[model samples]
Target: MSVSLMDFHADWCGPCKTQDPILDELKNDWGDRFDLEKVNVDEEQDVANEYQVRSLPTLIVENDDGVVERFVGVTQREDIEDALERAGA
Candidate 1:
């Protein structure tokens, strides 16, 4: 069972900029314990639509069991870490 963090963002989004580094740090710190998938909404519209992401910086946390949480806007590191913990990352 593996956990994944799907980050839906665009190049022109300001809040997404704030969200990126936090996710990057988590990806580096957690290593193989979790997977981080960065989705560029401008390029991957289908993926963004499939997730029904209407805004920038949508973070979807999922595991083998399925989605654990979905966050929009500039999410805090603690909240994301908590979701990862719940997803058994």
Candidate 2:
């Protein structure tokens, strides 16, 4: 099962900044277990729109089956890990 984590954020968003380190740590620890992509909403409005992102820090967990989980605002590391696990990562 393929899993992808999309982090939708903006450079100027404070909450988004807070979420960055957690994601980086996860990326490092998870290694090749899952794919991670950080999408800056300010620069990638189209991508944000496609995902229907309405919050500064939106996390989308997707698997081969499609989107499995979506989170808005500052999400915790545990919560993300749980979502990723559920997505078969």
Candidate 3:
């Protein structure tokens, strides 16, 4: 199962900044277990719209089967890890 984490955020979002470090840490720890892609809402509005993102700091965990989990606002590391686990990463 291939898993990917899409972080939808903008440069002006404070919560999105707060979310960044957590994602970076996860990337360091998890390594290649999952793919992490940061989508700037301002630059990648189409992708954000495709995901139906209504807010900043939206995290979508998807496997080959598609989206497995969606998180809005600031999220904890453990929660993300759980989602990755569920996605079979």
Model 3 residue 64 CA deviation in Å? 0.4
Per-residue lDDT of model 1, residues 1-89, tens digit only: 79999999999999999998899898888899999999999999999999999988899999999999999999998999999999998
lDDT of every predicted structure (CA atoms) = 0.94, 0.93, 0.96
For model 2, give the 10-residue run with minimal summed lDDT.
9-18
Strongest candidate by lDDT: 3
Clashing pairs in 3: none
The reply for model 2, stretches above 4 Å from the true place, is: none
Tens-digit lDDT track for model 2 on 10-48?
Answer: 778999889999999999999999999889888889999
Q: Which residue runs does candidate 3 get wrong by more than 4 Å?
A: none
lDDT of predicted model 1: 0.94
Q: Give the per-residue lDDT digits (tens) of candidate 3, residues 3-84.
A: 9999999999999999999999999999999999999999988999999999989999999999999999999999999999
For candidate 2, the TM-score is 0.96
